[model samples]
Target: MNEKTNRIGILPIGKVPEIVPQSIAAHISGCLDLPAIILPSLKNIAGCYNENRFQYDVGKTLQTLESIKFKDIDKIIGVSTVDLYIPIFAYVFGEAKQGGKAAVVSLYRLEKDTHGKKQPSSIVLERAAKVMLHELGHLYNLFHCADEHCLMHFSGGLQDLDASPLYFCRYCSKYFLDARSKS
Candidate 1:
């Protein structure tokens, strides 16, 4: 948890919403007390909605990581929507391995809140916080938790995301702390 030494890199896969990724990254870095580095603007990175097919290309993502020279990074986090057609988790793993990191975190919004009405609800921000922290927890080698209210709980829908708490459960906290100890 040494804020000065721990560097978290936020990479935009393609053209994503201007707010979501930055918001998520800031929230995560604040929670973990780590230095968050947002990468420079990218060109070839395509957005999920911008592509003809909904699929994400794992190989393409790996190529992007390679192009960026992954070795200089400590950890790279990718934010994308589930609708992007590609197996985002697979791409995450591919990139993580290519970068010589233990893991990478991927995030998707559970609710459809484009206009800031209806969908996301008031707790949308909290839900986003949960997703970022949950995925970051994975980077620390933490596993899913049985506690439905814990941030580590498996979320399948907006309700699931809403049901989960923003903070880790006691057991999960121990694992998170342990991971940081090693870091």
Candidate 2:
């Protein structure tokens, strides 16, 4: 495999809106400066749902995405409409294994208000892009940054996620560039 080609695949799992993945692909190229393509839509998320929490398990989602072999693709970012949760947290906008091949971002909560009301598409798209970039940073082995302005900063809620910038900080940008070069 040619590691030099760091192409990213944006996959929609379950009933994700078409615009969501399209916007994510655009963000990948425009902000991250990497080539991104949208993959075919997947219909089932069978084992991801937790009957108790009523939320999808993020670990299981990543595992499902990793199980698929995307030829010539260096990394994949699965976008889902379902709410995602890790056992440790109430919910997570996204999840990725450090330096791993696959990551996922959920648009479920991003489009909704604190009261569960829907927000405008523009706001939702912005939130999803932020989450995708943050998760992608983890895929590159970048850790959470203390700098609030960085895209790698951990967002505890929608407000925090909203406050985060779409680009990485200087320190993280250096690390990202270093990691990309080694790829």
Candidate 3:
């Protein structure tokens, strides 16, 4: 485990679109200036699926990340197509353990509009990148930002997420850069 080497892992769970894992890895590597790789998919993540709720428990899914850990992997993000929820909320685009190196983002809520219309690939990709970075930001020790459009801001729904950019705000950007430098 060489702490000096920074490598992030992007893994798809369940029935996520093929592009999401690569999209997450590309965004992290290209935007964060860190090495990123896609790990093997976790197909059985749906085993934790709630039949009545029609949503997956994200907190439990996050625990599964521990089994996929490798010495060189500094962080891991799991991408999923299923709806995700925590006990505190009805649904979440993603969830992360504060200060932990693992996170998961759900594409289920990000794929459609309020009218239940499917979003274009461009829009879907953009949303995925934003949510991925937002969840990863939490793992990086960043809080929900005050700026509404910042990637690190909390998004309770697709409209909120769509309103946000794929980039962090100035303060968050500085924090991410500073932390990367120290690491």
Candidate 4:
């Protein structure tokens, strides 16, 4: 697939680790050979906050991503350091509208100190990129890989995420290439 024109835009929702945006973009570019960029931060997260749960509602955040004004961005990813949740699930690493333009990842659970312990920056970045790739895979209509080692594999938590590599499996890679080539 020709990747020169494929651009993935990342939106940071709130205060994030300085390394996150560029780390993810570089990882995505190198792993998928696609042009990925750090887009402007998506502040104003208050509108999406749920007072009762004290977590950001991902559904509302996706609405925000859909309404964002960008210049020919191929895919939109919203990254946040805050805890994120949907109504049904207690927590999610990220969520994407199946085959949709927008996806969101929360660095909250990706952080080792999520319950209150500090984590090394390197591990943090790795986990964040893993989750982003997983969600972005969904944006491209790539389903959860049956292969446990693939990036497209569904991750229930940090351990599950850490077990997968930062790239897609070969079978999934073919699907990714075909989908991206057609797009």
Go through the candidates in order and give the C-alpha RMSD of each one to the true structure.
Answer: 5.1, 1.6, 2.0, 1.7
Residue 157 CA error for candidate 2 (Å)?
A: 0.3
**Model 3 lDDT per residue over 22-96, tens place:** 887888878877788888777778566888888888888888886665767888888888888987788988889
Per-residue lDDT of candidate 2, residues 1-183 (tens digit): 234369999999988888999999999989878889999887877799999999999898889999998877889999988889999999998999999999999887888888889999999999999999998999999999999999999998998988889999999999998987777
Query: Would you estimate the TM-scores of all the predictions?
Result: 0.69, 0.95, 0.92, 0.93
Q: How close is candidate 4 to the true structure, as a TM-score?
A: 0.93
Clashing pairs in 2: none
lDDT against the true structure, per candidate, is: 0.58, 0.90, 0.82, 0.85
Superposed model 3: Cα runs more than 4 Å off: 1-4
- Candidate 4 lDDT, 1-183, residue by residue in tens: 544446888788778766799998998888888888888786668888899999989999898898887886888888888888999999888899989989998888877754667678898898888888888888889998889889988888777887889889999999998988877
Off by over 4 Å in 2: 1-4
lDDT (Cα, 0-100) at 83 in candidate 1: 36
What value does the lDDT take at residue 113 in candidate 4? 52
> What is residue 156's positional error in candidate 4, in angstroms?
0.3
The order of the candidates by TM-score, greatest first, is 2, 4, 3, 1
* Prediction 2 global C-alpha lDDT: 0.90
Q: How accurate is candidate 3 locally (lDDT)?
A: 0.82
Candidate number achieving the greatest TM-score relative to the actual structure:
2
